[model samples]
Target: MSWLVTGGAGYIGAHVARAFIEQGIDTVVVDDLSTGRKAFVHPEARFVQATILDGERLVEAMRQFDVTGVVHLAGFKYAGVSVERPLLTYQQNVTGTVSLLGAMEGAGVHHMVFSSSAAVYGTPDVDLVTEDTPKHPESPYGESKLIGEWLIADQGRAHGLAHTSLRYFNVVGSGTPDIHDVSPHNLFPLVFDALLGGRTPRINGDDYPTPDGTCVRDYIHVADLADAHVVAARRLEAGDRLEPVYNLGSGDGVSVGEIMSAIADGTGIAFTPEIAPRRAGDPARIVASGELAARDLDWRMRHGLGDMVASAWAARKAAAPAAE
Candidate 1:
């Protein structure tokens, strides 16, 4: 059965799409190219250039591709910027999800894997987040993602839809030199860009309560995360029941200080990171347990921080000329 992959040209989406291809899964991609690059789409997969907001076109693509399942990843993903552009965020995230569900219904495609975010647990009190963590989203971005999950659940109950939302935290690194995280707000790209541009990357704070006195976060390799997606999709195709949500996380986490060290070692760029004041509401640590995911979806940290930084650096450096 062919699967429809929304946002397949985006950073994470591209990796997921490629992983599906490597697994011999037939795939079709739909992306508007708002934040995705056309080059990221695999040559084996069919591409549809359109936004999810365009419901009719989305349905047409779903039907034309003979899609039996879907992986929904298209949306506005910047949490910080959602504050300044709440309307656009909802339009692209909430409304767009609804439109996608409608398209799926129209095409009779029932199974889906939603690309959710950790922002849905904004500033959680627990050191380790779980699937059952109380969602107290602080930003429009988080709210929209939670809303998307709710929409999926409701649709599941009413229309017999099979779906699972995968909540991701601090997705970093590259699976290949051809693909890399390009978001300005992502940690890896921010540091890599600064170093590539001949500037020292700065850390916001170093006085946290953690062991290293810096923020600790779960950073899973993109390839690992993509593999989990393929597993979930296969489970759905096999009619296996799955959880409503799963977190693609690392049980043990790395600190920003540790990551900086990795970067230094990986790139051979030696310099102390400039420490700036912590941005308001920034927490000292936020890691998650991947026990459930590991049990069901074969989740694991296949690559270490050094691998993450080095692969990302290689891709980012390779793309520098085009970026300039």
Candidate 2:
């Protein structure tokens, strides 16, 4: 049996698909290629280009591939833009999840690993966020993710569908040079774009209460994040119980200034970032404790900040030619 990965062609989803392939897990990728790239899909896996909203198609694909589980990652993920497009965010994230779950039921697929977000804990007041942290999502995107988790849990309780949700923070770096983050909103791509275009990177705000006068956020490697998903999926497939939700994060925090410094050093381009005024609702610091995930999912920070920077830079540079 294979696992169906919705949005498997995406930045993080591609990494997840790659991890599954490496672990000798048969994979089936279904993507509409909205923000995802077809080039990122691995050749060993079966690919079906269709939106998750199409329940009939999903059921057919799952049955065709003998899918036993699902790794659901398809969604609209821009928190800032989600404010302007709440309807679209909910339709894609919440509605799409419902459609996927229905299709899974139709195909008798009972396992799922949902792709959740740290945005669910928007500007958390605590020093280190945990699974028990109070959820105060500030945008439609975050709200949609929380609602998705609720739907999954409700489905599990009613239908015996085993599942878990993974709340990811700032995921960076690359497992392969061929696959790098292409999101315009992400820090790595934003900085890489600025440098590649011969412009200085801009920091959103540098007057925050953080030690470095900039916002501090937990940054986890995309590869490590993918591994955790695989572990969770494996456990679910094995009928092993898991926490309903887990934060896939690095307990340590890194400031925006430190990230710029690392980028400069990694790319060998020395320039100070232009400081922009603070955006409304921006937090000074937001990190998480991965202790629970470490105990259950074998979660570990295999790559440090230096490794994150260097690998991301290498991947960005490798993609520069094609981008031009």
TM-score of each: 0.99, 0.99
Q: Estimate the lDDT of model 1.
A: 0.92
What is candidate 2's CA lDDT for residue 190? 91
lDDT per residue for candidate 2 within 1-324, as digits (tens), equals: 999899999999999999999999999999999999999999998999999999999999999999999999999989999999999999999999999999999999999999999999977889999999999999999999999999999999999999999998999999999899999899999999999999989998888888889999999999999999999999999999999999987898899999999999988999999999998888899999999899999999999999999999998899999875
Candidate 1 per-residue C-alpha lDDT over 1-324 given as tens digits, one digit per residue, 9 for 90 to 100: 699899999999999999999999999999999999999999999999999999999888888888999999999999999999999999999999999999999999999999999999999899789999899998999999999999999999999999999998988888888887889899988988888788999999999999988899999999999999999999998999999999988977899999999999998999799999998999888898898999999888899888888888888888888875
* Least well predicted 10-residue stretch by lDDT in candidate 2: 315-324
Candidate 1: segments with Cα more than 4 A from true spot: none
RMSD of every prediction: 0.8, 0.8
